[model samples]
Target: MKHELKGLYAALLVPFDKDGQIIESGLREIVRNAIDVQQLDGLYVNGSSGENFLMNTEQKKTVFRIAKEEAQNEIKLIAQVGSLDLNEAIALGQYATELGYDALSAVTPFYYPFTFEEIRDYYFKIIEATQNDMIIYSIPGLTGVNITIDQFKTLFENEHIIGVKYTAPDFFLLERLRHAFPDKLIFSGFDEMLVQAAISGVDGAIGSTYNINGVRAQAIFKEARLGNVEKAYALQKESNDIIESVLNMGLYPTLKAALGEKGINTGLPKAPFHPFDESLRPQLKSLIQKYNL
Candidate 1:
């Protein structure tokens, strides 16, 4: 709560070796790229972009440790400690808090058909255990747990439950949350919709694409805040062209491939997630060249 968590954040991408192990050196490089090159405000480590679900608990901790040690508080570092296992989430939350993460975000408890009360209790347990500010990572499109405004009201009652990384496409709910909980921090999650969320008054944003397109994202955020919607829209259009291509080629792999082109060892996406097609390299290069990414 004290960090005044606002501004553009790369959903911090982690690099891996062929054996699907954490490429620590590569990760340190990526963090440096985000802070130094991209000029992003923070790194959302171990979020969806980091392939959190695929990693073991130790791997997640390693990411938090490396990002903190590397960043050295130069920029904000948010550790996504959410997991299906409650104990794991708690342990990870504690670890991140100790390491000085700016904030802790947890995806809504998923997989099981958990009731609202169960979900609420899950958040409470983590906050109580860690004693750190919490951001609810609500991406119902993938998690299938849609939280209602009334439910949000219940969750926001706790002072430690600081805000949410709202990844859903519901602008209506986003607006309502903004109007209702004006004090709570709201981070827009979907990269392609950054302009709309910025216009709707989100504190800032977090996304995977920001790793490559962060400078533009900062422009869009600043322009929109300054009431330059036309400029923001134009930039958004150009950004969407890039985002569409990345999604079509493959999300994580294509992003890594883009970063790789810049001499950053971003490696490939983790197992179960396929790599970007070699055939697409020409096109991906065109994007990198076009965007100067």
Candidate 2:
């Protein structure tokens, strides 16, 4: 099935106060910046980057609702409603479908060392219940459940199982999957590897760093595909510099801090995730000015 839900998407970040309460205005500001300023193609709400795993069911739904409302069908939206709780996944999937998300993505069931069949069944259950297009979230590094090409073959047998958010660095498998399933959509999940993934034939990308560096991400993806290798790599190098620093200071908090610097009201991260270090403000500010983020 040819779908229109393909392009550069900010893995949608959420802001919260000290009590881990969602900051509604801050959240709206972030969404607005993503659409208006960053010019992202879409928002991937309630995904790992949004700290989805840390929030309860109600919080997740609130995010989905808020993003949909703020976006108002201006850009395509994909909801990452995956949870270890199967029932929650179904309910969230149904909810996002009702909210008119362009598509639904769910991480592979993790932390239990589930067999391939069980994981397959988990996806099947969500798709069957929600009756929406499903994109498999395959980040084996985090999930520890790797689906081989043949297994993907089996999952893709279902028309509702439309594609995958391929997060691993294994280009051989990516190439093979591209060759094997020309019809299925494949979105690269890593921001740092945007250039390579674009050249590897991914339909688009869903990334965390895209929240801040989406313009460059869009450039890298387009330049690489247009065979402007040198220009694409230049942007990738710049983006990687930002990614590396963000990883060093911290991913979520640091990104929020970067946005907060722009007066976007990106409050502190949820509890237990440390606030962005005040001492690093100088370095963060330097990065912001240097990159024009």
Candidate 3:
């Protein structure tokens, strides 16, 4: 269990064609880049970076199947089955489990002020149905729901609630969690704060940027773990420069654009999220040149 996960994972970004249909071939290219070029530890399929929320049921399953098929034992895979719909979440969980995903992560149900018990039970039901290890996906910034330390403790009581993909910026809670649950897996979510989280003792990190810039992120995590703060900080600073540019340009689109530079054919972002701004191409290219991404 300890070795199943614990390293950098690209929260995969999916590509879509003009008609808003998934470009399967492009997605396979991204997976190969992550494995062959970036040499990442793993891939986190169908998460926020995948523009998952914008996709429907069939599309999500398609991503799970494609990622699993492409990755195909090359590296670990965590399927993000979280959805606003609990039934959908459970169904996805079972599907991923059947596909033999390394683990299943579900975002805390959002859009309503659900009690901790409600949230806790949601996780329980998914675990019971799927009978697979679960990682709590806590990104309060996006979900508008924050799980307290006590809430995490309660959830972890089940043991099947293996760890968390903690996406918030609260280092205090991060430190507390590290000390409190030394045995569980904890993957940091933000690329900009990778060094900080590594210093705080997270098991690993998952980021959208890792899809293209994982070579540098791997260096950052390695330096920090080796107690080389100065080098790690330097790398973190450099990575954040790229992340800032990506965020400014639009996270998914800008990331796909980086892959596009590598001649991977990663398509544009799904509908309503807008495309890579043609005007921003030069800025993104500058980042690619600077980072050698």
lDDT of 2 by residue, 1-293 (tens): 33687788899999999999899999999999889888888888999999999999999999999999999989988889899999999999999999999889999999998999999999999999999999999999998888999999999999998999999999999999999999999999999899999999999999988888888888898899999999999999999999999999999999999999889998988878999999999999999999999
Q: Which runs of model 3 end up more than 4 angstroms from their true locations? A: none
Screening candidate 1 with a backbone cut-off below 3 angstroms (N, C-alpha, C), the clashing residue pairs are: none
Q: Which pairs clash in model 3?
A: none
Which lDDT values do the candidates have, in the order given? Answer: 0.93, 0.92, 0.93
Please report, as a residue range, the 10-residue window in candidate 1 with the lowest summed lDDT.
1-10
lDDT of 3 by residue, 1-293 (tens): 75579999999989999888999999999999999999899999999989899999999999999999999999999999988798999999999999989999999999999999999999999999999999999999988998888889999999899999999999999999999999999999989999999999998999999988899999999999999999999999999988888889988888888899889888889889888898988888888888898
Clash totals, every prediction: 0, 0, 0
Point out where model 2 deviates above 4 Å. Answer: none
Q: Write the per-residue lDDT of candidate 1 for residues 1-293, one digit (tens) a residue.
A: 53468888999999988778999988998999999999999999999999999999999999999999999979988889999999999999999999999889999998889999999999999999999999999999998999999999999999999899999999999999999999999999999999999999999999999999999999999999999999999999999999999999999999899889889888778898887799999999988888888
